[model samples]
Target: MADRLVPSISLKDFENRKGEITKQLLDAAETAGFLTLVDHGITVDEIEKQFALSKAFFDLPAKVKSKTPHDTKSNNGWEYKAQLRPSTGTYDQKESLWLQRGSQWPSDEDVPHFKDTTTEFLDKCAKVSNQVLSCLAIALNLPDDHFRVANDPNKPDCLTQLRLIHYPASENAVGTWRAGSHTDIGILTLLFQREGEDGLEICPGRESHSSFAMGDVFTPLPAHTGPIVVNIGDMLMAWSDDRLKSNFHRVRAKDVGKSPSRYSIAYFNQGRRDFVLQGPLKKYPPVTVEEYFNQAVQRNFARQQAATA
Candidate 1:
């Protein structure tokens, strides 16, 4: 396993030091394809409260939790640990609750302050996402808000997702991993993880390589109390004409025994479904977000069904 840490970028520098920070951001994006965000406006208290609400929601009885089930058409609500990752040809050992802006949601009567806490956190994530997008735009010599507006979450067709995922400890995890190795399908991902637990692993520069093998050389993302780990996704890589990377990553059970289930919050900032994914460089053919998303989903479902059969 290669012991490498994702580079950390300071959000505070976005205003006072644009050129310097743009270079730093570009360097990390091109090489490691991942970065840690620090001095971001989001506070520790806000994150904690949001996590509390998520825990409360996940703790509800199975019958009650079923009130809101995952719908492929809507792409929001809760899904059991049945996500099949085609990259590894296996299912993930985690359950996830997905949320989108303006999507119809179950009443928050059971979880105290659920609506308010999550609303604040999602807003903060959007703000940070825009800030990072601006830096990326400048690095690419495009307008500061070029990519920002391109991936506006408020757009009716855009699918900006906030997911709260829970991974339960299992006795039989040798063949099935927490999350099969795969790259995210969107623009960027801002992930918050519980402290002191290790599971997230990244295979740097794999996007440019050929072999699909889950390489033994993996770098685990360590858990910290603050600082969201930001990683570029496939859409952003395409927007940058392949200059940026969308590295493959997975979650493994770091501790086999005496380990509790893991929880993570992931915010996926994606382009509008109808928008073309081409940019100035034009290194790749233009593809609509909906086309890409639907193909990916179908591939996953097929792989999952085959494995079970």
Candidate 2:
């Protein structure tokens, strides 16, 4: 794997350091399309607590998890090895629990503090996302609230999502990818990985490269405590007149033998269903969030796994 430097930004004094932060963010968005954040308000204890809760939930019996089986229409609940990516042309080897505002959550008895802790964490994620989006807005010479207003999760029929995914320990099978190379559909994706669990990879030349072979070059992003990794996605790429790039990324086990199990928390910031999406420069035609979502789903169906186990 080629070693590419993914910039790290400090949100310690976000308000006072807009000039510095905005420069860092603009460079990252245009080139790397990925960055790490520190001092973003959420603490190490909070992150670890969420990891524990996720482990508890994933440890439940398959039948129990089936109570909230993944729905293709609404996109909530549990799914196993069902994420088929166009890049890999096969399923991603993992299970995930999607959490939305109205998502079916496990009881406190099933996973103590699952709902409460996650809801709290989700709000924190939103605040951090907005901070970054505000910088991007400034980079484009738009109002700071431009992206925030369109992506408010509290709005009705919003599609914002938080996913708790588990990659069970398994053989490092040849020609298999934990997550295939692909770009996110939403505006931004904030990923929280458990300490010491590392497997994410991001490719370079994202804005120019339209096709990738299995042997394409990539950079591996390691996980650690107290830092949240952020990736710009297709939504921002289009909204920025292709000036801001959304890169392709994947997850691959670093071990060549029996890979260890991995856990990750991902928050997707989506535009509200009723919001109209059109770049200020008219680079792309205007389309409502509802219309964009329907088209995206048809192009890339969220194939639910046959079984939970």
Candidate 3:
């Protein structure tokens, strides 16, 4: 089959259109497991502005950018060519800054208004994520607030992650990957991609439950549209009893020789660390958010080590 586009749903009349949007989202989530969202309230200009800010930070001298230093415990700060994935047994060809609570950030003098603007955009993204989560709750025959209650930011325990990634331009050599194949580790991931900087591809799963493996055929998703690409994540899949798919995706280095630098942003919507997550179907044992994250990280690293060995 030819390359396909992931379903693009709108939040134009969110309250009134909730049912319509929910069905589309639910169908996509169950099958293809990926989709792009439009009318999400973030303007093109605002997204572009954030992209420019991302570029500014990445353009800073190596020492300046490295000052904040990525912390594994907090999972925040800057790292370059550091994410080695299990699928390819190689470091991802990118540098990224991960932002979350208690993160040590660059000074405002270094990047004027960076923190203020990024935080503001994060709020907008969170709002969109909550709307989707609420709809998914309804689709799953649960209370509309089921997901939101766990992810409420005002509860003082809610924690989320926002990452800015810069994939430098380089030779499109064989055996290299911009971002190796992997599934996201949260409830949902809202991704903002630079227009026409396409390399993203997904291999939609067709099975009873989620597992990681390399697949031959994949579909290319366009990075040209204004909509933010949203993918169902592992936590959501578990919560939905594997009814929601968490497909594998990657950024291939295939045309990098003709491509420019790629900058992307992702907002990972997660719940409080202490929230006990148990789906109504109980396909998996109940686990706290904090415990789940640690388990997922360990599984990934073990797989990577085994692959390399």
Best by lDDT: 3
Badly placed stretches (over 4 Å) of model 1 are 1-5, 171-176, 208-214, 298-309
Candidate 2 lDDT, tens digit per residue, 183-232? 77788999999877778888757662222333377778887877888988
- Report lDDT (Cα) of residue 44, candidate 2: 90
Candidate 2 lDDT at 274 equals: 81
lDDT of 1 by residue, 14-67 (tens): 688777778888988898888888899888888777777778888888777778
- Residue pairs with backbone atoms closer than 3 Å in model 2 (clashes): none
Segments of candidate 2 deviating more than 4 angstroms: 1-4, 208-215, 301-309
Per-residue accuracy of model 3 over 139-207 as CA lDDT, tens digit each: 999899989898876565676888999999875544367898888888889999988888888888645
Give all candidates' CA lDDT scores. 0.79, 0.82, 0.84
Model 2, C-alpha of 152: deviation from truth (Å): 0.8
Query: 107 in model 3: Cα distance from truth in Å?
Result: 1.8
lDDT of 3: 0.84
